[model samples]
Target: MAENKRDYYEVLGISKNADDAAIKKAYRVLAKKYHPDANPGDKNAEKMFKEASEAYAVLSDPEKRRQYDQFGHAAFEGGAGGSGGFGGFDFSSFEGADIFGDIFGDLFGGGRRHSGPSNGPIQGANVRTSVRLTFEEAIFGCEKEISINYKEECSTCHGSGAKPGTTPETCTKCNGKGKVMYTQQSFFGTVQNVQTCSACGGSGKVIKDKCSACRGSGYVIKKKTFKVKIPAGIDNGLSVRMAGGGEPGVNGGPRGDLLVSAVVSDHPIFKRQDINIFSTVPVSFTKAALGGKINIKTVDGEVEYEVKPGTQTDTKIRLKGKGVPSLRSSSLRGDHYVTLVVQVPTMMTPAQKEALRAYDEAMNAFTKNDEKTRKKGFFSK
Candidate 1:
């Protein structure tokens, strides 16, 4: 009798809109709980493993999920050996099927043994990446290129690592079973143990001839270029995600993702303070005392600013909306503060020194007149 199917989402305990990360996380947790390795002699654990694996198989595939979502298990009614079908069922008729025999021996009974091949899909490991950006590029957001040393899909054998006109055959050592059994001596007594077959390398397949290009490794070192856009106002140490940019998948699984860590370079002239910029511009002593329009440098361009008469040294001149642009709000910008630094004249000519002496004498006469007027004042006494 065909058993009724449960909702895929219900089986994985997630919503229909669950993201890839959410789905993978849920699978990881559930898979660990019911892993056959963790529950060695429990028949119920074996059943749960098959059930969870079946659920993941459908939900992970977009097309399969769409069909399952619309028609339920009935949509896959004729899918032999599918989640609810038994057409692809194994009869345990193969050499070295003892691996499955050992597995079933623990589940059903120690006396029963099976001889069949193993089949399943597994995922690869995740990888990390970093990128460097200029200070201006980070502030204004720019695209950058990077070189990565990672495993890419093999091209010679199309990732199969097999030579032309030849294909990988089922492992003869384990008879495509992917595992082997051996007897071990222990204090308890003689025991039989099942382990992955070394000859087939656990993939249950053997290559008759290796591809010359990849040297049978199935992957080659590649220099891949990727463009990354830095948003305006992105601070240092911020991370950007590039999905499916990691290493190739295993057993036809989905590829992992690439995580980019941005490191921004420093600017020579501009100093950032959140959204503000500050700098010191040197002005001549005459410019400070005479009070006139002077050209000041800014990020936008040079602008003429009026200096007040007798402006003191080190005075800050604020230019609104001329500083760093805000990353979050493009319409708003910070102010730029230019501190005035009065420069004294050096290496004066002979005539220039004489004019300074004459100005001092004229100033002394006015000082005497001011002293005389103060003595007759009532407040002075």
Candidate 2:
């Protein structure tokens, strides 16, 4: 029995020295070409798929591979590798259980483990939209009501798409399976595929006397309002997902997600990075020189900040725990960075100009007053 069977490597079109990746790659090619779902009613393709699957099962397992390499197909026969599915052993208990599932998913969009019927439930597609928010609202989470045209089952025929007291007929093209199998010749071999029936659009039903409200789609569009909660510290261009808020599912499947991307308006004074907030605060020269309390604008509102004596322009200071709240926990906050920019007075009265001269004389802000000091100083200063 074992001598009559094909070599594992030969079945997969690989060499004895082929590695795990090369083995898997070769098997995937053969499996896609001869999958039962793709080539429905083809015994030859089904036999080929099972043979390739059996070959992959042995090659993918380390111990099985070593035994095969040493003793050939005889390694698993006559109580050597146990009894009986492929190669006198249970190929079902192989190492790579998910290999076939992943491969089939890549080729057919569904795993081989379940291989649900074509007319079975399928998750709906996601719905996407943008929402504009004020910078402050983005920092401190806020909720806004959004309106969209939501699809749901039609009320006229209770989602049947047929007129009252009427029923839909089974799709003739797919025979109510809603999918059709087709084969095409490729460079490697015969390439078979499964696609949604063009006539049924995967619905598996057809309606002649369609409902006027939903036509034959079995769905209706109506205004839907949702209160979307914009999370704190959610950066611009980032999306918030609302589960089961998208298009209605097909064949009793679950609804998809609603992805809302935030479009935050630029703040006049504040800018954000991750959770931190940054802004420039204009400090009067006197306040910077003498040190005093000044009101600084923040997302939270105006707060008094103490200016250090002789503080220079562009001096940065941090207000701890005063930035945007963290997404995980609102109590965990970031710091607000304030850049102190000393403002020079543009307009001055005669009295103010005289006061400034007296102040300049008293402070001696200009060190290059004397000729000796001027000669020792920088060329421009």
Candidate 3:
């Protein structure tokens, strides 16, 4: 059967005996010519670009190139073709690999290996704590100091994990790269494996004399106190983030954030809903019927509100801008809803009972007279 794929050397316009530099130069020129960016929507140019990439992907690596030279495409055709192959190739996975560095570096900018500590700084873990606030304290912001146990850089070694006078040395195993690379032969091709260096445990450094205080870990549990400001209008279960206030970072990275979850205590007299304050005010039956002024307690102070005559129980009255202030804007506030509840005396003295009875008799007589006037309506008028 005729071979289904062209030789990798032919794809890059290079001789079979070409050196690594020659192969790279040829691939770069071809890649620039057939790059999707340069070709726009030309399908043939895209196909040529992919074919060249596949050829360079195999030939640029010494092991893959050796295997390809010995067995051609058959080296990656069957079970012998290990996990390494263009079948599952992702250009992103080749980001830091030296095989595609030169060509892709020109096509998509610089390419650098992502293995080991060179991958970049890692952020520290976040710490969470709950703050309990009284309802009044939540309505008006307050500051409270909280104690937390978190990881802090060791003062003895200044986070170097070495003795006070001594210092850490670069790892001999990985040469301070924090990772060791090794090649493994598989059915598909040669696969490069990058793993954390066993000697320095991926820190890229080894301490000869460990710090007595931190035991070379570079961090210690510390009790820290921080004052957190509880903002107004904050509700239960809401979180307040304190930037760079949590655990100390690793490898000189930035500290993580401290998350304070609010736990607002319930108030006996007032209930809150999204910046609004609700409360029930009790008024005597006579006050509700005859109309009178009653004192209402608010976050600001006690205020007088006029009860409408003949007001029914559960009547709601709004006190505008008397509620909790907005967290975003302190000047903005919500309304306070006061529900009026009329209280009737369960026990009455004889004089009080007689007065109520006389009032009831007068109301009955007035109702009867009004009914008679309505009955005689049209003709009488």
Candidate 4:
């Protein structure tokens, strides 16, 4: 019906230069007014509804509208009426279900019943869970077993939800079509409105006798366990992902992924930052002043380090490649920083006080010499 010419703007009951919102508003008003349910058995109403939907669908798309404005009906029409045409536009390419609903809601009671439940192998939803690990387990890496409660395919019915020795039958209501259609009149013309069959939940099948175990849901809630390897150097708030370890899908769909979030326990001795370990080491004031070798503790055991004479408090000593192993690269590791704090004497015995007095007497000799020299210079001046 390419010869049947009617301006798209006229079909949508709008002016030639309708903005997006104006075009949308006009389409809504016209669609509701000419809906099939409002004027059943009216040919003119059905024809107008189809024409309005077609016009709005094209003009709403910039590319389609540009081509239509530039090439007229010939933009979509093939030579001598082949597969595509303007007046005979294909509604299958229209992807917006909401817009489709606005145009055909009244026709099918506000439902697009033809598009049934997704049948192709649909992947299950991704599952999220948490795991708690000890500080050592996180640093050294460990294998852990985690428990989870999830939906599993029912064993009683072999996941079909059908009782033993029986199987689900095709729904007799929709006759396996998964949909039912009814003819109605709209502003456009006669229209056949389709809707999902309520009897089968759009599966197009029905269990004549439901299974006792799963109750025909094809799945059951069960506790499951999975083993996960915690890589070394895994920090708090880190996450591990396991593919196909989540809940199984419906109708033989691919299984979803399992996301495991780790909560690492606090370490009493060592603190970590991005594969680096840090700790405080206390040193005696004598060791810091005179310099000596001191033994320090590590996860690998004790190691000795030389402290330089006159070492200041809060000085840091780094042990190269002595930190946690990298999670991304196993062979790589960070450095360890040991912050030193000089400890002053809190209490001294009489012997120590005597020794300190003798040391002060030796230092006073210089002061006495300086004082004598200054007096002699004063007299000479």
What Cα-based lDDT does every candidate model obtain? 0.70, 0.82, 0.82, 0.78
> Mind giving the per-residue lDDT tens digits that candidate 1 earns over 1-381?
335656667767999988766766676566667757778888888777666555665666666667767766765676432444422222132222333334446555654332443344555566677778776676677788877877876777888889977888888888877877776543212345566788877788888899998887688888888887767777778777777878776667777777788887787766778778788887887788888888887767788988887888889988998876776688878898889888888878889889877877878988987887886685767
lDDT of 3 by residue, 116-225 (tens): 35525768889999999999989988998888997888888889989999989999999988888766543223545566678987778899999999999888998889
User: Over 4 Å off in model 1, which ranges?
Assistant: 1-135, 147-151, 163-209, 235-240, 258-266, 359-381
Kindly report which residue stretches of model 4 are placed more than 4 angstroms away from their true locations once superposed.
Answer: 1-117, 171-204, 353-381
Number of backbone-clashing residue pairs for each candidate, in the order shown: 3, 0, 6, 15
RMSD of 4: 9.7
- Identify the runs in model 3 with alpha carbons over 4 angstroms from their true place: 2-119, 180-201, 379-381
- Between candidates 1 and 3, the one scoring higher on lDDT is 3
lDDT of 2 by residue, 1-381 (tens): 777899889999988889888988998898889988888999999989888877887899889889878877777764566445363444335534446556668877773443457788889999999999888788887898888889988988998889988999999999998877665543223334567789978888888899988987789999999999999877788888999989888888999999999999998888888889999989998898899999988877789888889999999999998898898887799999999999999999999999999988865756545655678686766
RMSD in angstroms, all models?
14.2, 9.3, 10.4, 9.7
lDDT of 3 at 224: 88
Q: In candidate 4, what are the lDDT values of residues 1-381, reduced to their tens digit?
A: 555868898787778778888888888888788867788898899888777777877787777788778777667786433236534544444432345465666556576544545334568888999899987688788888998987888889988888989988988988876666665544333455566668876567889887899999888998889999888888898888999978787557888999898898887778888888898889998899899999887656678999999999999999888888898899898888899999988899999888878878976997899999999999999
Ranking by lDDT: 2, 3, 4, 1
- TM-score ranking, best first: 2, 3, 4, 1
- TM-score (C-alpha) between model 2 and the true structure: 0.68
lDDT of 3: 0.82
State the TM-score for model 4: 0.63
